[model samples]
Target chain A: MVEIESMVPIAAVVDLVLGIATLSIISRSQGTSANNRIVGCILGWILVFLGLSYIMTSILEFRYGALADFSAVDRDKVGGTFAFTAKNLLLSSAYMLMVLLPFFFPFRLINREWDLWFLLAGVCVACAVFTAMHLMTNFEHFQVENFLFIPGYVVLISMYIRFIITEARDNDERLRKVSVVVGLVLIGIHGETMTYWLSQVLSINDLFFQRQSIQSGLSISAAAWGGINTRLTLGATAMLVLCAGEAWRSFKVGLSPFGVLTFIIFIIGFVAGLADLAVLDVVRSCYETQCEAFPVAYTIWYDFTSEALVYLYTPILFMFILLHYDIVDTKREENRWLIRIIVILMLLIVSSTILELIQSFLPIPDMISSAALAIVVGIFIGWEERIVKSLIDDSASIQETVPDFALPEIEHDFASPRLFNLVFGGVTAFILIVSLLFTGLGVLG
Target chain B: MSSDDTITSRSLLVTRESRVPTAVALLVTVVMMTVTMVDFVGDLRATDTFTSNTPDWNLTFDVQNYTMQAVETLQDDETRNLEFDMAEVIIPEGYSLGLIDVTITSEEEEGISVQCDSVAGDLIENGLTAQWNSPMSNLSGQDSSCQPIELSLQVYPDFDGRSITVSAVNEYQAMQHWLQDGWGQGVLSVDLELDVNSPLGFDPIGQDTDEEITVDVTVIMFKANISLVE
Candidate 1:
């Protein structure tokens, strides 16, 4: 019986590496314009916050022996671990960044002079409120923060639809750039839920949650359940909307690479929903009889689809959005080498992890897997230059691609890379210290 | 390339011609969100109840106690052996047999004579499925001068009055583990022995050579009840 390995630690390394690389690029972006630099910095810090959060999660998983044993009811499992508290708080902070991201990125929707201050204030107030709420209630309301994703979800989805429509209506290829960026942002935030689109549509995701609740002896509150439903609804709705929009565009205009990606995800959701139904007995085992383990086939299916999408591929998605959209300045000679290394590193890392995951379930020999990994590394190394060139060759900011749709440039000196570093760096420190104090004082697990 | 075509977030929603459509889209979105929430709440409540429609009340064990008494008598006898089939003893419903204890005594029949009797009781391990090796199961006891001799045999493993916490999917499931069956259903053998002594060198032959023996047997039984500590 091969158990699913914890990807929290691996995700931690990937996020931190990509996140630090992104921020480093943003900090040294002297030749980039203010708006581009600010947008790049925001993207960088989103990854950074997620990276730090994953690190805390990995620590907690190690200390608790496994991450599956999370519960709000079990005292030793819940309020007793410090890393648990810090992880949620940090994640909520990341979510704050996510909620504010779409307003500025691709194009600043609300271009007020005080927009930066609003973004800053939003993160601070939201993080503080969530941290306090979790501490007061012992994380019973952790999912409540999911509500914050609402504004961002609506923005991303609406923008995606708007651009796709405009692109098709006017036959402007440039509008696809705007649509693609918006699509990538949607994936970055709601990718996990989007994979459950079929399950959410069938309204069976709630059964899975009920199974988890019974298994962990957690009594999920109405508010928590509502939060989960809200996220799933958003994700499911987004997937449906995208599927429709992309199918229309593909039929009306012909299939593009982005359209193909959307269809693939659509197919995955359909299949995953069927798989989830196939294992309904295993899922209900907690209630029917003693809890039962899922079949290896089902577990492998999940490992490849949802888990891979989340832990391994999301950072790649973000990186793509960064470079392919010209959010990160890829043209500089100084940045080129670093970007090349990150690309190759991410490719090799993802390939090796996938091979290892395959080995966990399949009866593949270690030597064979190693050789496969080596081959993958060699291939990536050989194609590194072409991959980087292809990625950066047409990397143009949306303003340049769709200058007609782009907002007029605001020439004010927006906050620099240093200010973002300071504020977000302070947030990181606050999370660490609060987690430490809470854990030491036995206030929360 | 002109400012007229420059798109803000508002351009998608803010059109004199598109206002009604935008309102409809917003209305549909809000309605769908609300409907999704209602479905979630409904499913959550429905999933909470199992296919069996089990009662929310849980079944757990609360330690309870009861005892059954059996007695036998023999007149002018030196030794009396009694065989009791415990299966014949009708234990109450929802109760379990825990252990059995036996006592033997010789009635004072030496009227004005300097005579004494030694009595012993032995509870032999027979066809009973019980804790034969437990230190609490005393098989034999002896006493002098008609003092009561007591012996015991353990019928259940670790049976006590201590309450237990049971976690199960439902009341019916918990009941499956609590209601035990067919453990104390065998023959209980009690052998009572007495050694009689005559007056000081008077009737040395055979007169007053016997003593009356009495035996008392007790079967301890228990039933477990439940409390909802969840």
Candidate 2:
């Protein structure tokens, strides 16, 4: 019997390869501007850090049969290795970075506006301190680090939204639509984060989970059909369809073969993600009963389907960026055969997803479904490579133009020192009041 | 006409014909909004009367290495009741005891049967049995091969008694007088469980798996009064 836990390392290895490929493509591409290069590099590093963390966690979990913190485990049982400590540090750092990087995107780190830069720096420091506290603490429950993390997430997302609005304000009709679509996608990604924050502030986590009837109803509703990921997929699919429509409207032409292939793969992935959510609902309903008899296979199927969508998402985004930027040299007819191969490959992947979904309810050997899925994924990586290479080549020959949409140059106000002092004073006063309130409650209780 | 003029005319045509599509989109949006609102309202109604039951008070006792002894006052032929002062639990005022459960666990190699008899107050003979072999049952004979047994006793609040005394007898040797000495050497742990009901009988609203409330009945052994309210 294949242990579901063993698949963690395999998935981690795949993630690491994808991360490395993304970074290498970005670094080697001569067509990307310095700003795009910086953004791409940061995104690549985010994936790399996440992948490494997963690898470390999987290793430790496989050895110990559970993911235990360094302080929680017996060193003798784990061969006195420092793997747990390293895993904690890596994963915590990755989480902090993931929360912080969006604010720094489009090169906000070098902004001449001192106030914005100062705020960003302060947020970074807070994140670092909270991450350190999370690492050092042995008590895993009732953490105050959550206070900092949630606020940091909120601030970063707010900053990104502000950036998008500023971009849209100065852009043409087409670019504005693009910005709006991207904004919707970003909101979908962070919707769950905001919900968690609201739950924490209201102390409603228990109440929220206890509404089984509501959850069941939501499981069937279109708005929350597949839970949060369904919403995400909806936003992403909308973006892709809008982009395709825009391409058609502007160029008065049909999609290139590459575009068609990418679209097909994305739709298959979105459907598969939705199907996985339904499978999860089924598994959860029967988890303690029917699924208990075949725990490993059910768990592996759930993880595989879920992770497949996540893996597909990054490549889909890459394809979307290519389409939105009009980087594909469709006029070149040399790669027609390659496109045909890609189309065939994508069709196979779609068939595999359908097969896997059907097999999810069947009594067939899980290995057959797993092998089919793995083969397609292996082919997908190579296909992604060819597409990225073609886009890079096309982009190199493209000349820079005064874009119909241009970002507005931001000027920092030499804000009167007195106003700055007043603002700082108010912030300090608020912090003091909050601290006093907490201290008073502690003392009285 | 020139190509640029043709393109401009086409764009105008498309714009003029866009009204139907725009209205259709608007209609779809409204329908989606209505569905979401209806679902939201339904969920609110479902959870409106939902409330979790929280026990007003709970008392748990952990008795370790309790060695059973034959009553020396009685002759072996008369009765072989192996007795120990399992635990003495006190329920605070304003809260009445609604349930009492006892679990006896042992790790001895030999199998034994147990029965409980009330010395004072009322303990309803609600026969509820729970048996589970220890994970180490497959190990050597020296290893703990015993199973856990649970006894649930219902108590009435009308009894108005704050205290209760119960004695556990080894049924296996109680019937065989020849094994009285062997049964005396048996040691087991006991857990005394009590649930106190609310005065108004209003169940608490939600269950928090994170923070479980447990009251130590062993504190009663020191004659200390404890009341745990959740």
Clashing pairs in 2: none
Question: Which residue runs does candidate 1 get wrong by more than 4 Å?
Answer: A1-3, A69-75, A78-80, A217-219, A285-290, B1-6, B12-32, B39-169, B179-230
User: DockQ of every model listed?
Assistant: 0.23, 0.03
* Runs in model 2 lying further than 4 Å from the true structure: A1-7, A25-32, A67-88, A104-110, A113-124, A139-173, A180-361, A366-404, A408-445, B1-230
Instruction: Put down candidate 1 lDDT per residue, A91-202, tens digits, no spaces.
Output: 8888888888888888887777888888877888888888888888877777887887888777776777777766776777877888788887887888888888888877
Candidate 1 local Cα displacement, residue A286, angstroms: 3.7
How well does candidate 2 reproduce the true complex, by DockQ? Answer: 0.03
What is the lDDT of every predicted structure here? 0.75, 0.35
Q: Could you tell me the interface RMSD of model 2? A: 15.8
Weakest 10 consecutive residues of candidate 2 chain A by summed lDDT = A285-294
Looking only at chain A, give the TM-score of model 1 against the true structure.
0.96
